[model samples]
Target: MIRPATPNDAPAAIQLLFLAMEDIARKISGTNDMQVVTHIFEHLFREPGNQYSFENTLLYDAGNGVAGMIVGYDGGKLHQLRKPVLDYIRWQTGAGVCPEDETQAGEFYLDSIAVAPGNQGKGIGGQLIDAAVARAAGEGMRKAGLLVSTDNPAAQRLYERMGFKVEYTMPFAGGRYHHLIKKIDNA
Candidate 1:
């Protein structure tokens, strides 16, 4: 079943977030220590309005644990949503980042998504994307967008299969990325 994530999902969700984040997690944490990154993000995850908060997350719970997650929000709110995270990073790591805009007006951005390694090949990812799409449509979004690393062809193929088309290529998080979008409304 898919449901909005909550504080209780932090531990599991952070692991999944870190898995999806990969190198970005290290950048955000300002360190390569897995424990420190997890600790920092888990703290942010439990908060309510930040970009990494539970307010922006949904997960698949298969009666036992969180198998996957989709974290996203309105592109127009990117700055508002990211402020808390930036503040938290400064407070916790004493460092800062000037992340390039990976999203913009007129879409609901899918910030991150990952399925637990144990749950791979189970079709859970598609279901999660479907859920996010439905939510975006219900919220009156014109489109849904996400950034995929250009080097990750397999992931790009999955997004293509799900109706996303490359709108452009740009630099983000220290690599080239394809910014893909799929219309979610008639407009």
Candidate 2:
């Protein structure tokens, strides 16, 4: 079952968060240390209105436990939602950065998605993505967008099968990525 995540879910969701962010988590956190990154994001996870807040996340519970998670929100609200994250990073590490915008107005952006290590290969991820796209359409967005690294053909193929087409290429999170978009027909 996929449901809206809450602050209470942060502890269990921390690893999933790291899974989604991967190395970009290090870049944004300004530390190569997973412990520091986990601490900082756990703090943000408990907060509201930040990009990493539970307010924008959905958790896939596989009866026994959380199997996956997805974080998405209006692309137009990127700057507003991201401010707190950047501020926290600066405060924690004394590094200030404004990475290239990964999303923009007129779409709902899937900022991150991850399947738990133990639950992967069971199709939970595709289900989570479908749920997120439906959520976006329900919220009146005309498009849903996400980024896949150009180097990951397997992931690119997966997104393509899910109907997300490459709109263009862009540099994001210190890597070249293909920005993909899927039309929200019902919206």
Give the alpha carbon lDDT tens digit for every residue of 1-187 in model 2.
9999989999778789788776887887778887888888889999999888999999999888888999999999999999999999899987646678999999999999899888988888899899999999999999999998999889889889999999999998789999999999999
Collision count for each candidate, in order: 0, 0
Instruction: Single out the weakest 10-residue window by summed lDDT for candidate 2.
Output: 92-101
Clashing pairs in 2: none
- Superposed model 1: Cα runs more than 4 Å off: none
- After the best TM-score superposition of candidate 2, give how far the Cα of residue 96 lies from its true spot, in angstroms: 4.0
lDDT of model 2 at position 160? 93
Q: Worst ten-residue run, lDDT, model 1?
A: 90-99
Residue pairs that clash (backbone atoms under 3 angstroms), model 1: none
lDDT of 1 by residue, 76-184 (tens): 9999998888888889888657578999988899999999999988999999998988888888898999999999999999999999999999999798999999998
Q: What is the Cα-based lDDT of residue 178 in candidate 2?
A: 99
Model 2 stretches with alpha carbons more than 4 Å out = none
